[model samples]
Target chain A: MSETPTLESLQAALDAQQAIFEMHQSMNMEVFYWWCTAIMFLIHAGFLAYEMGASRSKNALAAGIKNILALVVIIPTFYLFGWWIYNAFPGGFIPAEASAALPWSQSMGPDAKDLGTGVFWAAFALFGATTGSILSGAVIERIRVSAFLILTIVLGSGVWILGGAWGWHPDGWLLTKLGYHDVGASGVVHAIAGFFTLGVLLNLGARKGKFIDGVAQTISPHSLPMTLIGLMLIIVGFFGFLGGCIIFNGGDTGWTTIYGNPTNLSAFAFNTLMGFSGGIIGCYVATRDPFWTMSGGLVGIISVAAGLDLYDPGLAFIIATCMGVAAVYFAKLLENLGIDDAVGAVAVHGFTGVVAVILVGVFAAGTPNVNGLPPISFMGQLTSAGVMIALGFLPGYGLSLLLKKLNMLRVPEKCEELGIDEVEILAKPYPEAGVPAIAASDVPNKLANTELQGA
Target chain B: MGTSITTWENVSAYFTFADNPMALGLFVAGATVIVVGLIRSIIKHENEAFKQHK
Candidate 1:
């Protein structure tokens, strides 16, 4: 005769089975995270296209290649150390116990048991790549490839990630000590990238023929269609970016209280559209130019992106409109200061990010932190924004100045005169398929033949 | 843990069909082809850039 199992033993067995099932479910969700990550990667393609289109025909290939190379350098560097920096240095500003988030951590690699680290790391890497790319546009026509590459590593894998650790991370000192909140990286990504571009611009100086008798001259884009396509891609990628940040895996609650529930997809969608519309209209009214108008949409979203999850749609629209109008003036101000930003990146990303952070204080006032800290306040937000600007600008400017002193920041004047395309790039973006090749010696003969034919 | 085919069989049943083996193989082949095509295009672009410089 067999003895029946006790009730306590059966309950224990059931608990063990439940735990195993939950682990499997978590792993499945992690697989979906990778798929979402791939979608977000499309943003880089958009950035590449948009930046290339905005550059002059002579500089298009150089600009495109530069942005692409930034990604190449940034990805490996980020994988090796950047993600760990974010996790480890969150308490750097305030003296909290340091946590080890080394690359060799078990959660970082493929494991059937733990599942969140890889995708989370990837998401931050994409942010780093974007930070590097935004600076590409500002110094396009003149920056030395080597200098820019160095800057890319510092800003992309170094500075921006540091900002994330300080402000955007849950355990970041800015958050823990100052009650800092940057939901979608207005301060961490856009502000830092913009400021870094400004720092480099101060040392690299303006492009050849950019200024005339102390006045800035406008340089038109090579292709408008390509620029438009790039902008649209960025808009689409941003949706996934903002959405991905909200992911958490606790219990029966789907996308709930563990992470702050400031807003949902619908809220973001509504605010994004309104902000874009308002920005475009405002920019058009200010500049009466299609280029600035399109840029207005971008500036608008960036301005409100920090607080989109918290702001009402109407507030987002108003704030975006104000930011767009302000950006045009700021771009003009930078130009007058002899800082030539080819794509207005400083105004669009840097200035607008600061503004967005400040606006969050107003809109999110009295809102409780996810961790039950004090409500969002204007002073707290201002202090956080100031820290972001200082951290990004001071180090970047110092590094760039040092690079300039080493004579490595800008290309030779001869290369600038001949165009970086024919000099250093050594490749023509467009190869003539039908045109006959004529050597310098043969040019006279060809001209004579054409003249004789005309006679 | 039980060294049983119960879980394995249940999972396989979802994918099992009379023509599934061939169809799955063909699908994998198609994906590979598409990926190869994209790689070819990227390589062509780079080659053209190199040729222009030369």
Candidate 2:
């Protein structure tokens, strides 16, 4: 009467459905990582454009080239050794299976068996590049490109990665021993970069004409619109950066943090948006300047980043608002101290990063360490923060001082007077704008000028 | 096998090694590299001074 399915047929149907489900889950995680890696590229684009705009028209190209070269150098270097450093240094001494990340490793190339490592490495490389970019803007119009590349390699590939291995990695000594937790690298990437740049700034000195007779001068950007647009691009890129922070677990569990702590994109989205808006409001209240206003959005996010996984959304907003205001003022304080931070990288990244690290202790104390070494504590984060600052600042300061002694740190004063673009690049970003259309000898005098105006 | 939710405690428990000599060696090696890089940069600069901008 009916063509009923036999036990064998039913079993086969069930197996087929299970296989399809498994395949879909794996594919989704792969695509997710790829998407995050793609988004992180925006941070670099934003840095390039923003620094170019902040620089004088004469130095725009120099600023831009630095960014491009840093990206190029850091990428290859990261592949060769930086990846190994991350995998190996969790114990703060030796890398575990560090050879596995070497260029000769089979997994280093396309392998059907391993789908996640490449994309994960891509995302981390972007993070490394970002640390270099943060330093790029602060030192623009003055730093030697060669020195920048060397420092970028050191910081991006060596120092920052070491910090990550010690703290950010799942098996890091900080997490295992001190119960340290930083889900968003507020301390690992931002603070280290920010403070390291501070060290460089101390050695590199101020931009020429930035301070005169013990008073600070505002060296304005050539194009305000360009800077604004660049910042917006950075925000777009940040979506990718934060996405990379997550570890995608296949099947129903969905996502977790790099430390294997349970979390969701929904929580991240809520906190990120709230913090952004709160920062904007805080910045707008203090300084109506569009630059700081937009920057508040970034500060807000950093302020909330340390506790992004666990904070109430409203708390995220409040913390972001306070930090947004605080960041602007902190930049002012550094300016008062005669530091020439071209784009407030230190305040935005360093100060906010430190605050975020400490705030986690205050706000998120007793939160279970995702790796379960010890509970989150104020002392633990404080210790971790101090160690990170020392780790970052010492090498940066030491190396920059050595470069300074060698006279290879900053462009000569003459170059600053003429601009790096004119001296180094021998090209113009806006040749037409910089040079006049008519020849000096062909000038028609006032009568011709009147006629031209009439026409 | 299904994925496992790894808490901080669970992760810490999993990596049960009491000591890591490699990590200590890395710290020393890293310090050495930074110092060497700085000195090397100085030497390189002395041998071939970069052209001043322009």
Candidate 3:
């Protein structure tokens, strides 16, 4: 009994197909972000090696421990508050309506209805942790592990995520009001972290011999090879990070940036490679130093990161080269001002991010954000840059200042001279390097190692 | 709507968040991080402080 095809029947069948298509799209996005999270962990591993290699043999283990601890500590804190901040404060506070983002929300878990939130939340948590990694390198050797851990919590779970809520989120005021277009989080993550580290350094003081009688001296890395390898791993992680910055879907729909502007991984890959090379060239030309040269790759990517979804590969290279050169000179400028940023994080991440944010306006001006509410402009990015700097600097300065006054910020003076690994960790990084472990008996008020062992 | 956590019938049998035991479990983990970090700072600082009179 063949019945004439009715409009209702055709519509019903079409609706079923659309439902299947949408489900696949959601599943694909979830899977993509899951991998993105795994790849992003490489950034932390790279940071561990990079900072450890940068440290003198005495403090290498301490640097490794602090970096690892920051990674470990940030996870639970991010779960409790960082995710909530990202979802709730995107509308500039009051939470108006974000119960679904609450840690306690039924929707926050693996609900059959929503496949995206868990994976998306995991990716965002990794992004938040990267900000802590950026701060970790700069404060190595000199910072108290607990103090570093707390500051990592504050920055990773609190300050930087708030900036992300304002700039990175879709409904963020910066996006709605100013058309802020940081598709790669140049401002929210890198600049904020760099500025925050700067504020902390001003309070933490120079590592004892970093400055001598008003002159800055170079403290050589223990192993340049490890640092160079670690830098490449961070670049690889950033590729995954950039992949997460855009949305993917099934069917013929074009990949789009977080702001819904059409882009693809091809655009990201091209610009990342171009920018990475450009930074290396510029840094080698400027400093002729391997560490800065490797770091120039980071500077390059950050310099162009603001507009990765938009720039021509050639333009990205040129801009990255300029910023790479600028980062080295900027690091020197800060050094002159008595700020001792160990890995030039202040210049590499902070300075490059701010300039890249502003430069995107210069290059991509008049480009409309999603729905064309407002066009990108230099003023908009410049304004957002100011806010990011303040968000990073204020909490960093005030909280670290409190830590300093509490005598909990820097390592005890004697501890700094003896390597931190030997002083507190009790394990020598190099068994044959002849650095003796400091016994607790050396301190007048401290319990002796033998006494504790006897007990 | 599903509230029985021990039931194996469906995944939704567990309700998590806020006041739920699992949610509180997460909260306790976060609290431990904060407390342990503070304790470590204080102990390390006191253990190695230069003697006030010396």
Candidate 4:
């Protein structure tokens, strides 16, 4: 026997349903951002494996350890000042509204009232750390761990965060005054990291025996399987990285970019996939090499990233393919100049990133910015690119030069030839299986004996 | 009873926060752990240099 609902009863029922709906929506938003942050972990894992495999057998352990340490050190520094800087300097050099992000701020901690802030901050922190890892691979085999950690902190938690504030934030000067638009941080993250690595590489110089008599020599990776697998993980992680770029509004009301413009995840999905395929195909066609073909995929995504929110999938694909071709050729140009990139990060991330941001200006001309600002323009995007180069390159080159002068940058020439792993790690990655007198137990004693002999 | 125009208050309400002592304590604890761990790592890495010169 159902009662016919009076007006009051109907109203009560509606209120209950609305409350439940609100709760569900709140939880879903938190879950979405958490998932994005979790997925971004693969980016670091990929970097670890990718760097290890790229390094020669003698320096593999050293290459891998520095990456882990970078993550360890950058997390705390980022919390201390990096998050604050993002909110503080969005207006450019002025610490406007930085209180909300201070380390002592209640909102920055684990609180029942806020479920979203920590996850969001974690995602951005991952972005900063990714910038540090990019420089890590280029200067591997020669760099001391302590010196590398110092540079990592500067780039990861300091310089890169500053770039993000000026370019990616909603109130950023680049967005407000210049009408700059970069949906996927091609300039802020990728370009800054890529060029910063170039700056450091300039100071670090080529590895020993790399360019004898002014002729370049190719140093091959120890394991292609590991490198390829690592890259695939990075591709998977990128899905999460791009997801963080869009803010989720409650329910089906849709999402917005950091710039407060309306966008949809469907558009991002289409462009990312098409761009990735185009890059691989383009690289395969140009170099016909496996490494370049795979790296082309990364270049392709970066190439199309700035325009991802607005591009037709076909257009995204075309742009990515062209960038892929350019990345391989540009890498060759750097090599000819005797710049040993070790993994072609400069061409893949830096050059393609700059080109992509500029392309967005040409392609997305007249697209309206938020708050009734003028449309996105060529000069705005170009100016942002120029700023990123200055922020990324100058400190990288200058500070690394300073480290070199202090004798804290590179290992001694003898140490470089003997392998960073043996010199620092005190262990080998792969021990010979069939050495009668050389046992695992003898390693420490052997190390001690050698040390005593040297002394 | 009200117009549908969005104001600064409405927009600011979209950002979430929790101003409580428990949350503050959690931030301090997390930070302390990271700092301690970093110090330990630096000590260990530096100590290894005594074993080999090349």
Give the TM-score of each candidate: 0.81, 0.84, 0.89, 0.88
User: lDDT of each model, Cα atoms only?
Assistant: 0.75, 0.82, 0.85, 0.84
Interface RMSD, one decimal, each candidate: 11.4, 10.3, 4.7, 5.7
- Model 4 misplaced stretches (Cα beyond 4 Å): A1-13, A433-442, A445-455, B1-51
Runs with alpha carbons beyond 4 Å of true place in candidate 1: A1-28, A93-100, A256-263, A433-455, B1-54
lDDT of 4 by residue, A290-400 (tens): 878888888889898898999989999999888888888999899999999988899888899899899998899889987886579998888888888888899899989
Q: Chain A TM-scores, all candidates?
A: 0.89, 0.92, 0.92, 0.93
Worst 10 residues of 3 chain A by lDDT: A439-448
> Residue by residue across A229-347, what tens digits does model 2's lDDT show?
88888888888888888778876776887777789899889988898888888888889998888888888888888778888999999999989899999999999999999999999
Write one digit per residue (lDDT tens) for candidate 4, span B1-54: 222223445232222233344655576678867766675576466445623563
Model 2 TM-score relative to the real fold: 0.84
Query: Evaluated with lDDT, which candidate comes out highest?
Result: 3
State which docking tier applies to candidate 4. Answer: incorrect
- Of the pair 1 and 2, which is ahead by DockQ? 2
Q: What order do candidates take by DockQ, descending? A: 3, 4, 2, 1
Q: Tens digits of per-residue lDDT for model 1 on A71-115? A: 877776776668877877777744343333444343444443346
Report the candidate with higher TM-score, 2 versus 3: 3
